[model samples]
Target: MPTPELIPADQQLSWRAITDADLDGWEALLRRMAVEDKPDWIEQRADLEEVLAAKKNNPVLDTILGVDGEGTPRSFGRISANAGSNMVHVFGGVDPAWRRRGIGTAIHEWQVARARKRQADAGIPDGFIRAYVEESNPGHRALLESSGATVVRWFTEMTRDLAEDIPEVDLDPEFEIVAFSDDISESMRLAHNEAFQDHWGSEPRDEESWRFTVTHPEFRPDWSLAVIDKSSGEVAAYEISSYDPESKELVGFIEGYTELLGVRRAWRGRRLAPALLAEAMRRFKADGMEHAGLGVDTENPSGALGLYERMGYTPTRRSMAFEKVLS
Candidate 1:
């Protein structure tokens, strides 16, 4: 590929993986361009660190930067290894002031090339990559689609308001809501594997991955809740949410996510999911959050959409996933 011209900025723009030293600039750029529903730039420091750590250690993950003519980074993107499968997650951001200048398209083109190069280094297939873009984020969706990626899944970031009375959900009397903990974490992990066991392209996760995801910077153990059978203490349902100040998540957008709401197989259709979600919303409301959010697979076997809808979660954004095979 010919060298990308330096951005119009006085200094020449260069592109490269974000290092710890680049956190300041990267976060600043993210804050300036990110739209609602995306993580705030300032708060992304830790998250980006996590992404970098994964890329640095996993060998399969990669990040690219686009600098201006003056050696200033104007945009960036990353690809995370999907150890559960051969696919990778492609993500990125561009300064709002710099849009329509081909910065986004440039970064995406670089991302695909980076993914291919990583595949060569790791000796893994140059598998197609996937990305999630909010249905409302037309600019980003256009960039990815124009890059030859295809939408494969439509996901929803749902919201449930806690100020409203908690809906009466029918759950077994034996099950009780419990705070998150190591014990509950294991059960939550197991439930995720089971609930998504047959979901398209689902992959098994180890304790290591679970540890990384669950303990993310946004994790607030106290906000997480698990439902268990009183006698056996077997986890039946659970809610995972993370904290984000209005600064991180623009106002009106859910500052906290109702991250994961999982129910055991035998407990399906028993109203466990809603009841658990209601309880979580109640908790989030008490914690002073105006709203809580969660994502749902449109084709969930457990009818997750109906459950979330019943809980008063409207569709805020339809996140679409796209893929293109690279072999």
Candidate 2:
């Protein structure tokens, strides 16, 4: 185990860079907190190997586990920045048992300091610190607001019942939807960048960062669909799906998740995306999925949230993005 760095506010409590040895204890802390805070939702296990792999891919990132004298992780935080964006993303959680103590604040303080140091090293003139909190997580929201973070954007979680028949939409004859394949990976990646480049806070993903999402343990290329421009032979849009066993096992029902859905500018208003979404839902239902879910930016210029609702998806929860400027 690595040496623990004691927090000034509480000597008994300390944090250290997490190692493979801390996986079990860290999992225990996350599971306990998830069961207590949201039993209805699945307890997603953090893959320590994958996380460590990410650190190798991006050495600037810092991941820490905070523990008490007994050596159980009471708080966790990850701080990372995107190249050229001058923005650092912060995500962390405190065990329910350790809430109301100074542990959470201390973790945030450490994250801010680490982010500043990284910015300095990179010679970034100015940067922004960003975090996301779901509406269901009131404690986190309160903490962010109290720490001078202000809401910058809102996101919605939408779900559709797979048991119901998906409406059949007549796709334009010029467009074709097909399963995602390694052959078209590069094309799809470029299309993805083109699709979201205009969106707020959008950052282009290099090959390394792009591979992390598609190669994740839960990624399901068989379920991920891509729309092709038949005439041009170019990818027009994509809906990348994944099999979330943790959520399925938690709720005792099969669920298909989509983390990314993009339609290139030229394909907008062509009914291409809606056709792909319907096809995706049908594919999920055919595979015995009970539900399909995705998160959408509420203020997306493409009118994504409205389109989702029109396609039979209902909002299950709201998540807000909070930001603080750090130079």
Candidate 3:
């Protein structure tokens, strides 16, 4: 175990989970990070209240941060285990001046130990822990590695400058493209489950999951578009989009988050995904977006990375997944 260099009694700090009252500080830290590193354009915040409301109910979420001897928050970090599993994921950022003194490693140790406690309390068996580390920020990767994490796979964050004007698609005469309204929640859930069935670490998403998803503070229905089988009126492919009018000034980033884009196996190889994505891009640009973004696995079996590249989305940040099996 790595010992955190002592911060002297006057400076020794403790860690705390974020509370509703910490929103200001939390937002400040997030915005500050944005200024320091303009990450992918897809990261947005459409409805923060809804997100915080949902987060309040999450049993597997803990935003851990260190506080100074004076009780001021000096860092921000989070540990989240996917529901119904022992696979905890953690990420953190310490204040600039306080870094390089082992505080990050200490927080990482604290996060892992917390995950272990959560598993024990829930009677879950020991399993693997997973996390994503961005190549743009080597310091974070180093911190996680110092805590025994090993990079297992790399993923790419792709961005499409909607300003580039991807061509429009002439939807197949037999297909219908439409906004996924609230009433079609079930269809969205069904489509998402099927679309992601073959994806890495994917699991079936039911109604409960959909309920939580669309209502996330960041979910914007107007920005979301879907395609359906005109004959059966069943959802065929979908692409979700969002723009945080608040982040990065009033003119914000629009993200084409392909939450679940797929044509059922029966309808595969019809070029539905690219078609839907193109439509989504056009719609977002029309709504005053300056840029669009999406994340794709470089080695996805579906060749999604190639498709995004074809759409003019270049990789801006290289992120790797780290996993460790618990003994």
How good is model 2 by TM-score?
A: 0.91
Which has the greatest TM-score?
2
Better of 1 and 2 by TM-score: 2
User: What is candidate 1's lDDT per residue for 255-302, written digit by digit as tens?
Assistant: 567766666777776777777777776777777777767778887765
Angstrom error at residue 45, model 3: 7.5
For candidate 1, report its TM-score: 0.85
Give the residue spans of candidate 2 off by over 4 A. 1-8, 39-47, 55-61, 249-253
Question: TM-score of each candidate?
Answer: 0.85, 0.91, 0.83
True lDDT of residue 325, candidate 1: 73
Sort order, TM-score high to low: 2, 1, 3
| lDDT top scorer | 2
Clashes of each: 16, 0, 1
Worst 10 residues of 1 by lDDT: 1-10
Point out the higher-scoring one by TM-score: 1 or 3.
1
